[model samples]
Target chain A: MIPARTWPLGRAGVHLVLILYTALCLGPVLLVVMNSFKSRAGIFGAPLSLPNAATFDLIGYKTVLGQGAFLRYFGNSLIVTAGSLAAVLLFGAMAAFALSEYRFRANRLLGLFLALGIMVPIRLGTVAILNMMVAARLVNTHLALILIYTAQGLPIAVFILGEFMQGVSKDLKDAGRIDGLSEYTIFFRLVLPLVRPAVATVAVFTMIPIWNDLWFPLIVAPGEATKTVTLGAQVFIGQFVTNWNAVLAALTLAVLPVLVLYLLFSRQLIRGITAGAVK
Target chain B: MDQIDKLAADVPLLPAATRDAAPARTRRWHIAVFLAPALLVYTALMIVPLADTLRLSLFRSVEHAPVFVGLDNFRVLLTDPRWSLHFWAAFRHNLYFFAFHILLQNPVGIALAALLSLPRLRGQAFYRTAFFLPTMLSFVIVGFTWKLILSPLWGVAPALLGSVGLRGWFHPWLGQEATALTTLALISVWQYVGIPMMLIYAAMLAIPGELIEAAELDGITGFAQFRKIKLPLIWPTVGICSILTFVGNFNAFDLIYTINGANAGPNFATDLLGTFLFRTFFGNQLQLGDPNMGATIATMMFLIILAGVAAYLFGIQTRMRRYAL
Candidate 1:
């Protein structure tokens, strides 16, 4: 390693550039959240200032919470995200295990077939997907969203998990076999536990898109009963476009959960990305 | 004893007592068991629908029935003025959006990764997290947040610019036809630049320390070392980032839709293939929903993406070797 020594000018320059861009990345979000807590006049007049005693208000939050089916939307997102994450992990791992661990006739072909979705987006199949869902009489239901998200997330999950599974100790697997463990038992009891870190990585990749997706949800489950938080926020903000207070509050409400989660798991998330773990 | 155990363990496929009873074909069901669920879900929902979309694109609706009109919709989308106008306009906008990203986003991401990877950098985690925070937010949140900040009524954008002595430059860029798509592309770039940064940073970290140390001993340090050593090593990652940007840009809809609505407003200046596909597939204020035409548009997008990916895979990726780290 290059010895850490004084390059005061260069160091300051790097920090300055990083700090400036960080503010740019975060400033708009901070502005919205800050202004949401302010009075209407406070927002328009002094949008930059923090909420003071006179300016602080909850009218925006009241309006947003009062009008929108946010709780339902939150529940919908939670169910879809959780459901898709579980399915993607389980089926993805199984397929990944088979693809990496075992030799089969169509192994390479099947791997290539599934990996196609990674480069080609699933949204292109929306026309037929909508029809399939409609024909199945599953439109405007949570199952539609769950299944689509699972399909969308599976390719990347499999690709990543397959790479990790290839590195799993074959001796451990053979030992499991010698101990009279079936392949299913080997996968569930032995291999699955060994690849939990990769699972966590896959979980992050699968969860965010499902939670944040607007297109599939809008097409497949736009009904108020099944609207995700992202879709709900879109619709709510659209109708109340002129209502600055409600709009800001709705945006913040949409933002808060994700921001909180990111702050909590950012270390792991960054590690996963930086490890080149998911690619 | 160890050799005997090894032989015993390895001879499962031979005439061993337990293994000989079950032939390879007999045990094939286990592979099927492991692979079936994923194949079913993925094929039914993703792969089959993609194929079906291509088929749908080849047919047209006539008297509430889809008729086999091979290449007719594609003809209209390309040669006919009325449909082709919107189609090409959106296609053009999508190109611009992709160009904006390639120009601004990837370079900045590379730069940020370079800075973060600098030896003994302080608070690297803090900067990385801060930079990546926006990428975690939903498009609705990012779109609406930026909308509010850039709103002339809110005065936030102007106020921020005013502090920098450029208040006169403030305008509703999102509302203007000329600047709308580019502005939105920049907004998207702002949110997603972290992805490249993180990926590139990881790749850079994987560059063995000994190589950098040897370069340092040769008195080639800093930018020279990055240019000579680090850059070439990360070439494969940069290629991945490029293809990802292309695919993601083409697939992008939530941002434009969330911000500009389905119309992709200001006279459709911001219309992308994604927004165009949505409007055509699901009827907006402009026209009735037409699945056949929507499928046509979706097919065109898929072809375009396929071409890009094919070019990358066949044309570009063949030469970029991933160094064993």
Candidate 2:
């Protein structure tokens, strides 16, 4: 039998602290989700109680579906996020590969230059970005958000993926070179697949901020047709602030897609984030 | 497993200095091809806009056209009573916002990480996922969720407090002048504590098991073991997390804007640089939007962030890199 551990906190104590925090973190979210399924009276009258027959209602979801073009907003977000992520992965990986594999004079300087955005937010230039978007007639376009997200994601992508690519064996690339495979083919067929885990990590990291962002969408795409789901929820909630059921349902709708996707990819996300962040 | 699958933690992304440069300079077209797409998009959207924002700050729009008015925008922002009052208040509130994050969020995150890292803990996976759930949700969801929970009319906060014999402590936190900003800060902490916890946990896991076992053999265990052995090794992760929190807080807007509205209401008690910038750029009932003055505020934010980042990269990070092992 293992000896009892000598610690300031007993095992039970540790578990208690964890449980309390878990509740604090999860209680509000669960409260919102459950109440979204309840009637307005049910929500305020019995806030913590799980939905029963008396409390169950679909009115909130109906209001949300009837009013907001949330589906269209979801489509816009999907387009922008997927497009930007694809661009970030391809462009960011290529840049990372070049910086890592090629021994050049300006390589370090270039790497440092690209890494600047990791610390400094791209939002600082929103004024000029809006100007450029209007001038280019790209305002209210998914392309505008996608291009900005690509730039936003590239720095950290290069930072993380560059590290992973540096560890890819030089021998394999050299063997491919000897096999007379073109360099581009080597990158596509060789390096990218080899760095699949890192790419997964980068995808989740790059996808999140783009998805949850309200600022650019609010500024560049506030028109009814161009709203992303996040901006849609914000606008919807703002208009329906007094309508509790609709507000909760709107937030729940905004939340469900991300939560569902996260549940599906949690393993990959957890592994990838932990691996990619290694010092 | 192939070599790539056997990733190790010790390797840095880019090495310090390579003495042997590659000899093939003739067929170098792929290099530009590899880099230009990313560079072009990044420069056009990021670098060019940043430069133009700086330039725009030095100009004023006269009859829908920009006219160069050097230092005048800065003077107005600093000295003009109309602009300066809001500017100074927002600046002061932003510091308070950052302080609450640093003092509260980092410590709580560190504590949770320590507990989660304990040996033989049950439900670790569930707790990790659950804690990170709020972080995954958009700030809109988080803000509204907390808003409903803390609403006095909804009675959840009051009822819970009463159950625990502290009903009087419950107030309309989001609507009160004295408590509004702190309430928002705590709500934000709840949403984001997962980040630092996860980062530190990752760093802790990266610590070699044998090293920990060796410490146990030396009769150093539990909190003492953590204090002496684990804490020193994990300082770099803590440092990184702290800086991340600083950057995130200074750049924060969504929660305050969503829960408190863009006016940062309760008489501007919760106004931050981000919300201030948003109000200036976009305008509200009281003020019409002015892009030049907005750019001026953005430039100031840029310089402040630059100073913090430069200090971290040069001062703290270099020192911590040595302790990362």
Candidate 3:
């Protein structure tokens, strides 16, 4: 307080920059959401204005809801995301535990093998995955998407969870052993509960790609019953390109669930990223 | 208090077990049991398919059976004018895509990160959350929203630009072939700048406070302090951001595919290798679906990514070391 510090950009300047960038980031999204509620005339006439009584319309939403299979698409996405997240967590934790806790032969090689997918996308294997899926008669099945996504997600999950597992106090596991708990019991009961933070991190990382993935659903399950929200929106928007109201409404529908979930879990999500879990 | 609460939460999950419940013998199968599920799923679904795709690239189908044709597909992709023209064009567009992100997105991200990481900054979380909001939205949402906003007839782009005295710059950037790729690249940047910003912000936060305090005492402050002290320290994170940008940019298909369809229309001005691969495998009006060629293109993408990763590992990373804080 005795001597005020000088900055190249004053405090006010810094805030201006931040505020401008924030507006840049948020403006387009707000625009789309705003226009989705406006009538066709309002959308074309005054696209930037907020919906007023004269311009308000629910026709787009009604058309989107009435015409498309968005509910089924959302249900498919939920099933795939839930199924894949469960598989990724349980299997990824087990693998991370084995790789970290127990020093086994070929452990480093196996760990590296799994870690490959963290950098390289699994979509490259689509040609063969499609063939295999067709051969196994698993195409258009939720189980197929779940299994593939589990594979897609496991590498990073194992890597992140493995790092965290290595920090779990050795004393805790040994105490479990001394208490006559089996190794399986120790993992499910003791280790699992302790790594809840890492689990949340993994869930955020895994859920986004699986739910929003378009390529796999497009290739593996393009059928009406199997389409995810992302694919459904793509298809719906493609078909209704001329209708601005329906198009905006469909996109808003596709975006709202994820935006809501993100808002709900944003604090933990930011913590996970900042905690070096992603690094 | 938080640690105690977390410990309390964990206590009830692990039920107390008596000595009699334990098996006398050491169960050697625990490791295998734990590892098998992930291993089986990863190997069968991910690894095996990758290997098979590679193998498929080396063969051509003959009489309903694969005939061994070593590197012929690769040769065709590179030399045959029919395939090579599109291949080279897409490759160039992809490079342009990568360049824009590196030049624009990374710098912008670093700037935003530096601004957000400033001491005593208010509403840091609000800015961060707002900036990252688009990244969380599905590509469909981002693609469609941008498409609508950029539409000349109904979009707010021209109106917004006009209010800011930049009305003449408003055109259908997505519709013009010359501007389409660059426009899409910038749009892609808008959606993804949050990633690099967050990563670099995390790295900046990892820098110890004492170092900054020492720099402050030395009269090194503000932009100078950032240039000399913080910048050097966060180089590793910047390197990571670059390589991730490279991989993500090259592998990008969703936004383009969603907004521009599989054909990547306006005369295929926005076609990327991903969409090209999809069309080749799935067939389109341009050509029949050929798995061997599709595998060949996939293999090429894999090699290109591998090269980039290797360059980062061997060339870039060696120059940067993690400074001990």
Candidate 4:
């Protein structure tokens, strides 16, 4: 009975810690977003407060939108991310299906070879990749980014999908086989539908990093026409460092879409990670 | 049905009907068809390039011609004081960055994860989402955002410091040689702490309630239970997190590059191995590009990562027995 008294105290302490930590996590982002809406003087004066009617300013937004190639960068990011995710998922799933389902002599060796990419950072191979891209005349194009990202993303995607595919019910495939369905038909018409959740997980896992990556974009596709959102914002903000309003506004603009997407899919994303997709 | 059963019994089972039987030629062809495209793409794009990078390290470019320099590029990178200083500085900086991450990021993550995992914690989902929000955003956002917040001109830092009545502590941290790298490392820690927290929280959840109850019965609760029981049990997860953190930190480039440029400056304090390699591969204002030198640097980076992974796998992993719940 005496020990019961300690429970409330413990609960209160836990709540206190969580609340404090949550504040720490949210504070900087909140400050940035709030200040992005205020005039420069208002931001400096009351950094903690929200934008008031009198202090409200869209000058920063106007400047950022006016000078930067924001829309083009956004479009480029979308194309690269979507293109890479599509290639990785399709190829990864197919390879995973074969590796998991078949009993070929070289099956283990093939899987091991694929797993090697997981450990070796793809950037280490940039020298040859650039040379190859130059030789193929693919530099300064979105195709360069897409191809590299697809290759980079495939190993983890295949690894995760393979693990998930191993747990798929074999009875369904067997039934398909007995019904005169071809192996290809079984994989596509039946197996693919069942693995939609894993697909979502893989998409989330692969999309964020590719969208956020800076190296390949800077090296292989840094042309003005091919700049990704990340590189675009970095350059834009660097060029206008002294313009406080524009800098804050550009940073906010860069952060907003991802923030919205994250809030929408946060659960699925966390679920995927905790599900051991990368582990 | 009786006649059909009798007919089936009269015939022996075909080889294909057996569970462990070899697949027919047609099925084998199907396997190859499914596997070929992905293998072709992965090998052509990833494997071939990696091998070529290693091979390129052994050769030098001479007047639009390639000459085999063998170990000369590597020797210059390692032995010559000019290149070696930047290489070693970046290497040491990377190690320091990694050490800071392990010390601060992992512990803070573990602590936050522990609190979040409390069985009856209120607003758990909200806390989880908020904690993870920064991680989903791009490094550009994180880098520039932190830079603005800490900028002395912006007064955001001063204001926050003023609230706590410690306004004298405000300085331009990102501009200081001593503080720049550490400050950036801390920012990175802030952005990524969510990952380890969520992972560790998941591992903690996998621990059974019965074990907690048993530990509680033995008069262990809170931190005591964590240290005495939970810590040992979560060591494997921690191990995995450590190695992941090692690789990620060693490979990290964007944040520093975005925040500090390829020079990684304010006197190169923030320069890491990634930035160093980037500068070497794509020549900066001060130097012409050297592919052989860049390849040598990359090979060294690869070796470092390999050694670290090997240490984790053989040295740390084998010693810790993962508890099966």
Candidate 5:
């Protein structure tokens, strides 16, 4: 039998390690948010404490919100992320259905071609992509980011959806065929609805990267109207680097939305990841 | 074979009664139809540009037009001191950045994952979620947030150091040539450690609990159990995590770019291959942009990544012998 005394010691040690790590992980983010709420003097004086009545200040927020197109940047990020997700899911599912359900000579080759994109970093092709966008007169526009992200997001979406689709009940598709449903109709009406969980997983995986990406926005859409929250925040903070309060507030603003969304979807997000959906 | 015959027999209106008849032609067309749109877009956008980038590296742009100059761009990039120094420096810095992640990030990730996976740990989900919070935020945010918190003017770092009676040790870590790249790498490690942690945690969770229970009955618990029993079982997952870290670290851009600027300041000490490529492609304060040279750098990056991936596939992955349990 195990030694009972040893078990308590081991458990305590585990908690100790965990508690320390948790602090290390959350400390920097906490420090930023905490200081963002304080006046410059208070921030320096009591950096570890929460903002008190005298120290609480909105000057930082006022300055950050006053300068940069923060709200516009958020809207641009949302539209680009949402658009990319919709395209990747819709077209990706359709392609996956065909690859998994149907037999064709080039089917395996096509899948392999799509899978190659996963291994290769898409940013390596930025030189040509910028040129292509310029030729098409689409530079500094949201459409450019949307298209590029859609292309970037497609391979993973198709890979995951295709793998999941293979496990789907084949008898259902056969039954739909017998009911005189066209392949297109079956894909939209039956198959799409059935794979909702996979779609959700794909959305979480795809959206976070797209929403957080700074490279594309910097290169393809850095104009005032099309700047993403990531690019906008970077530029905003860079200009106000000397202003500690404003910089802290801007950082808090950039981090808050993602934190809220993450808390809401952390469970599903973890489940999706551990399910081997992305890998 | 029987299913094929049955499928063929169902369509009795066709001229041929055999299973391998005209219907196969229509079925092929149907498959093509389903696969067309996605294939078209991917090829047009991703494949074509990548292939073009590889091709463009061999040509020099002369008066806004690309002219074939095979190996010339590569020669200039390698032999010319101006181009070669920056390229080699960025390359070495990238290696250092990557080494930091492999050495620090993955080990820390594995350790946290191991602790989090301990049986009956209270608030396990809360710890997991909170720990992963930084990974969800944009790199731009992570970069700037750390930059501000560590700024000498802000006093957060100094105050934290004072709490531990080490206030004088604080420096402008991001602004110093000696410490800048290493600092950025550590900040990135802090933000992304959750990725490997979560991946390894999932892999550890996948190990059969009955095996652990059996080990426990044999007096295997705590560090002894972890070293002798758990580590061997999770080797393949660790291998995968290493390769993932390799690829991710090599391709990293936004963090360094945001925190240190595209120049990767303090005299380019923090510059990595990504920033080098960006500055080469899009001219900064010092130099005119050169597309051909930029493409050449990108092609080199592609080759490096490909070689790394090939090594992982052929070397580490094949040897890691995953446990069936």
Candidate 6:
């Protein structure tokens, strides 16, 4: 049956458009992944065709695992992203609570702070950031990347969370205050649960850039033990520039973990985005 | 006020009716406590360095110590033909790079979103997940994947073109100076089009169902319904997508760097403000690194972004009407 709200359009044409565009979006990524499973000859010979029995190979995976510390890099990336996400969410929520629940004189000033953050691409300050990192002796350390990523993410997190938190029934908060619960207790027990969906929204937005960033890791944490997955993949690509099979394998490996993680949480992420889209 | 009094009566509050209780001065410290951690990290690590970078632009290194040199670096960057040439070229290329997104990415995103948000559309979730998948991958992976597909040695692009009877039109677009920037820009579009689509689709979902039902009753339907009923409501979101694209395009570095390296060349054809800044700061084979010059370029980038943001806030944003849904 036709939905009550939907427009009555040429349904067949719409499906055709959506399917074609979806292919364009997803086709290249699938191709790289498919080609990763093939021999170099197979890859170059029939680029679009499926890998048959003769072309099927695991050589690329073997070379990548033997030559690179890919797992270690993934661990470093995970630590940095998880650490930054926690800081941004917790501290951002606290700041958002303060800015929203409490009517302070500095409130408008703080709002402008978030707006200025939009214009200031954090990388512009990398010149001074590097110097500061060296001074603090944080170079090649996960802490360095974490600090920068946390800082980079907080403004937007606070900005979004602050506005979202305002809609939390203020009466509920005041009742907790009247019951002698401290602000911290109220924030942790009462308000946070109310804003969980919004926090998830902020989490997805904050985590992606941290996971995929090549800049901060490239500058501050380029050490073998400290390299992020993105930086490691870059170095690997440079090292294996001529080895197509190995290059494709490394790309597949780099992409697989993210794909798995995304599938696990993608429903929550989409729901959270829609839930928090009420601006 | 009445509800608070009744709630206060029910609670074990021994003090006088706590209705309209002033925030106890003792508990006010919690505000600062709540704000301190985020504020400290954001200011010291982000705002301070931004200010410092701005300051660094006015100074030149002397004997490995910063020496205040006023606007000399800016003058040199703008006037010195050797420096000015690359700067202007990279700046121009950045505009073109941004142009490609404005022209292609936004339109495609809107079109797809409009279709996907239709009430009876099936498989919306699957399509969204598929569309957004590429944005999850690192620029390194995306750049390399595309490079391999478009490589002359691999013949994937040529082969695909041949299947479509346009094999002769194929070239190593990523290698040719004239085509490299455009090619990378399109790849970027392909990767990122989902973002605008998701955002705009969310906005479209926010449109009141009554509006659509009303439109249906009025004999307005199909694309015409979208134009009159939906477009006006979603205009603010579309504006946001535009500004975000502007900021993102100007800040872009990793994709170009991953594909073309720091020189951003086929003779610097794919160069952008971001890569140019990176090369000037880090120095390539041709020149020693110059922190002062780097800061100046960063300052230029900051100003350009500031101008863009300011223009949006004061100019374009002011003109758009955010419908109260």
Kindly report which residue stretches of model 1 are placed more than 4 angstroms away from their true locations once superposed.
Answer: A4-9, A277-279, B1-23, B321-325
Q: List, residue by residue over A182-240, the lDDT tens digit for candidate 3.
A: 89999999999999998998899899988888989999998888999999999999999
Q: Write the per-residue lDDT of candidate 2 for residues B270-316, one digit (tens) a residue.
A: 99999999999999998999999999999999988888878987988
lDDT of 5 by residue, B158-189 (tens): 88898899998999989999999889989989
Q: Which prediction has the highest TM-score against the true structure? A: 1
lDDT of each: 0.89, 0.87, 0.89, 0.86, 0.85, 0.87
Query: DockQ of every model listed?
Result: 0.73, 0.73, 0.59, 0.60, 0.62, 0.66
Q: Which 10-residue window of candidate 6 chain B scores lowest in summed lDDT?
A: B16-25
* A117-188 per-residue lDDT for model 5 (tens digits): 888878989999999999999999888998888888889899989888888788998899899998888888
- Chain B alone, TM-score of each model? 0.92, 0.89, 0.90, 0.93, 0.93, 0.92
| Collision pairs in model 1 | none
**Model 6: colliding residue pairs:** none
Write one digit per residue (lDDT tens) for candidate 1, span A1-279. Answer: 366432323888989998998888888888888989999988887888999999999999999889898889999999999999999999999999999998767989998898899989999999999999999999999999999999999999999899889888999999999998999999999999999988997898789888999998899999989999999999999999998889989999898889888888888888878765334
DockQ of 5: 0.62
Could you tell me which 10 consecutive residues in candidate 1 chain A have the lowest summed lDDT? A1-10
Error of 3 at A160 (Å): 0.4
- Clashes by residue pair, model 5: none
> What is the model-wide C-alpha lDDT for candidate 5?
0.85
Question: How well does candidate 3 score on lDDT at residue A56?
Answer: 100
TM-score quality measure for candidate 3: 0.94
Please state the error at residue B266 of candidate 3 in Å.
1.6
RMSD, each candidate, Å? 3.1, 6.5, 6.7, 2.8, 3.2, 3.9
Clash count for each candidate, listed in order shown = 0, 0, 0, 0, 0, 0
Ranking by DockQ: 2, 1, 6, 5, 4, 3
Worst 10 residues of 6 chain A by lDDT: A1-10
Candidate 2 chain B — worst ten consecutive residues by lDDT sum?
B14-23
The digit string of per-residue lDDT tens for model 4 on B1-325 reads: 9999986875566554653444455578888888887888888889999888888889888997999989998888987998999998999999999999999988998888787777766888899999998888788888888888898877878888898999999889999999999999999899988888888888887788889888788888767877888778777877878888898986689999888899999889999999999899899998988888888888888889989999998998998887668
lDDT of 6 at B74: 94
